[model samples]
Target chain A: MGIREKPTRMDQVQSWRADFPVEYLYTTGVAGERFAKTLRERGMLAATRCQRCGVTYLPPRIYCQRCFADLSESWVEVPLQGVIHTYTVVPVRATGEPSQSLEVIAYIRIDGTEGGILGRVAVSPEAVYIGMAVEGVLAPPAERRGAVTDIRYFKPILS
Target chain B: MARKRESSPQNPHDVGRVMREIPERPRGTPLKDQDIREGKVSLIAWKPHLEYRWDSGVAISRFLLGLKEGKILGVRCHSCGRTVTPPRAFCEWCFRPVDEWVELKDTGTVNTFSICYVTWDMKPLEIPQIPAVIEIDGTHPRVGFLHLLGGIGEKDVEAIRRRVRVGMRVQAVWKSPAERVGAITDILYFQPLE
Candidate 1:
């Protein structure tokens, strides 16, 4: 009914390393359909607008959370340019191993959109700063997948 | 004649009237398969990886350690006099904790099996995989764990696929100790002995 006290570290702890592989497919419902379609065909970013609340979501949602209104087809193509809202420089991978070089991640709010998208920053970490102007760099048209990766990364827009 | 008074707040008669007045639910324009195939509608596909770890805990930790030493172990329920392989800490049948651990033979008999022509991801395989439940010799007759079957009937006749069946004797083909990590994978697969 009760656990006994551990005699020693070796007696109490034993671990077996295992790598169980799992994969899944995520569906981006009604709102995502319009957003992804625009990205794949026109290489432009789209967002959903809540008619009642006046809130625009970049990773478009199918409904307004606050009003519970269905946003089935309210799509808008905002400019593919924006300023960096925030950023981070990480020299370590998700697994905690040291990366060959630092990776800069930034959230870029496009010119005409209220919210911004979080994506990789291709520019050097030293060159990255809050409020820096940047633009999306898209993959070749033929190679474009209907995913965020289609926009390869964002780079600094020099004057 | 008796007249009805105003209804109680808890029992609102107007709820059904409101439901009858509301519009029916609407379905979105469903994207047909052709829309995705022909680029008529944008369809994004994502492959997400779920990386996770599970702790084997007390009973399984000891069982796996035994496997590293090239032995199979089971927990014994002294109350029911039954031994279960792929050991459990408690007995479901007897509703009591197992009394002791018993080492079982590496050899076993096939309880049931399947010849798989495809991989888990639904990819067709050139050679079919033989997955089977092998009941260990020293444990209870009906108790067993799922494993694959290999080394069936002879190379001369090539009749292994035809002859492999339930109740066929088999043995564990252990990986070399150097490569034997403390896991179920330490014993690669079960092989038909006769």
Candidate 2:
């Protein structure tokens, strides 16, 4: 420590408040673009299958993670219904503030694929359970944007 | 060199085979920013906002306080005998603590200058700004800080560039006492001394 003459009063100290803003753009890749476009235009879920490893990916990827196989040309339409693989009840908002209502956030295991997508389930926290069959409730075709939010939420499938 | 071959013809297939195989394989579809704008593709946009506070420690704290009082302050390193403005607590050369403070004249000479055509945010500016490194009076030569220059009375970029010169004498144009808040900005800018 360099011993030196220091200001005794707190008033002698100075501080500044500042903010840093960074803006950026990210493009959905080849398979991801196809998945978004298909969901947006046709109100259907799209996936890709690796011909070499036979593993399917949701939010379609260009390459298979396991075998590093190119799956660009193996796009497939997945069903709208899936089973809840796991879920948690969030009683607060993302900012950690108390919310008026609880939400059931879950990982949905899509039918005919090993991978899953995260979504909000439209059911009571107590009523929702693992392996519960749920169908995606998509926004109207005209209202759909190429975003995952186009599928508003998942609800229990009718018997 | 005339007799040596880069590789034996039998083994030349190693790299060439892979090069030929790549073109036939299916590749990812490429899209441009135009595609995203035209709604032909999708994108994800995110902006995170963060706020922070910075404390102006020992030397800078005193310097800023002097600015609020309408004075320019600097530190003197006894070991090197060099006075530095926009003062620091330690002599970087000698690695010795600097505690002596000196009051410097607001006037200085421009060591270097630049005419900026755009704002810090990269937006086009109608009247280009003139920023310069002004070597403060009473400080060692070339020991100066960057500050904007003003009062040239010219808005055209070329005219300002023609007028401003290295070694031109300038004086700080301080803000009204009430407007100052112990910040470097207290000195609005440096104006050429007539």
Candidate 3:
């Protein structure tokens, strides 16, 4: 007959903390700063236009890549309606962070605009589709600022 | 060339005369195939780690600063009459130079949006967050952006839609002064019109 020996525990569980350091540096030109200030005080959206191609961007720019020409200040107002381009639903949690359930994401094309914007989908994940009309929702007066977050997520425009 | 005869050394027992002995070869240990396969070997555990530094352009920096001041800014293309929110220094369309500044009305409508249950890192947020695309008023074509929505409950999706229609009035909600930074975090979220 053979004899067998029982295994013994060798290591114990332990916890420790480590520091995570991150640093960020950024710089903005004079024209860009002025553009942002205008939005903050005026509650407006601005973009740069191509002098040669006649194309307008939602977020304004300084130089024209096509014509390589210096753009002149010619601010114009745009409509607040658009169509849905694409969408998705996100449902995942991060490690060592808060937990959430399903989330709706979408790409929206503003009315009369050629480009599209990416953000959260306010509608049901199952209800979203391409070519659906939508619009922007601005923040309160007290909360109004010349920032992207100034306009909350776009909700489906029923009327 | 002269030839020479070979001569022997005076010492009869010289070290060079003796044959050098070779070292013995190492012996191999024999073992069963099963025993060798079942044996355990030491290993080191490893985990993946990554780091990055984002470079936001000058235009983006200004836009973030504007958010800190509670504002939404866009740039305009003088040649094409287009307005861009989250202002860009250049125009992507028509390949032209955009050198204009336009301020958009806070009152706009929802172009489209999503209710975010996850954070920016693709992880679940502690609380469900609403992200939407809003088109600013008084801009050529339709100008829109992505942001958080408020003044509506999580289940009240329809109500939020009604309040943030394509042309409904809406405004931005800013964070406290102390917490204000020249970044998107400046504005906590946007609220429905009263």
Best by lDDT: 2
Candidate 3 TM-score to native: 0.38
Can you tell me which runs of candidate 2 are displaced by over 4 Å?
A1-8, A157-159, B1-37, B79-81
* Candidate 2 lDDT, B45-94, residue by residue in tens: 88887899999898888889999999999888888899998889899989
Worst 10 residues of 2 chain A by lDDT: A1-10
Displacement of the residue B57 alpha carbon in candidate 3, Å = 1.3
TM-score for all models, in order of appearance: 0.62, 0.82, 0.38
Worst 10 residues of 3 chain B by lDDT: B39-48
Write the number of the candidate with greater DockQ, choosing between 1 and 3: 1
TM-score of 2: 0.82
Q: Kindly indicate the candidate among 2 and 3 with the higher TM-score.
A: 2
What DockQ, between 0 and 1, does each candidate earn? Answer: 0.20, 0.47, 0.01
Binned by DockQ into CAPRI classes (incorrect, acceptable, medium, high), candidate 2 is acceptable
Candidate achieving the largest DockQ: 2
Candidate 3 lDDT, B1-194, residue by residue in tens:
13333344446555566545654655333455564356321112234354554545545655665665667777777667777786766788856556755556666676767756666567866556677777777665567878777767545556545555555566777788778766676767777776
Screening candidate 2 with a backbone cut-off below 3 angstroms (N, C-alpha, C), the clashing residue pairs are none
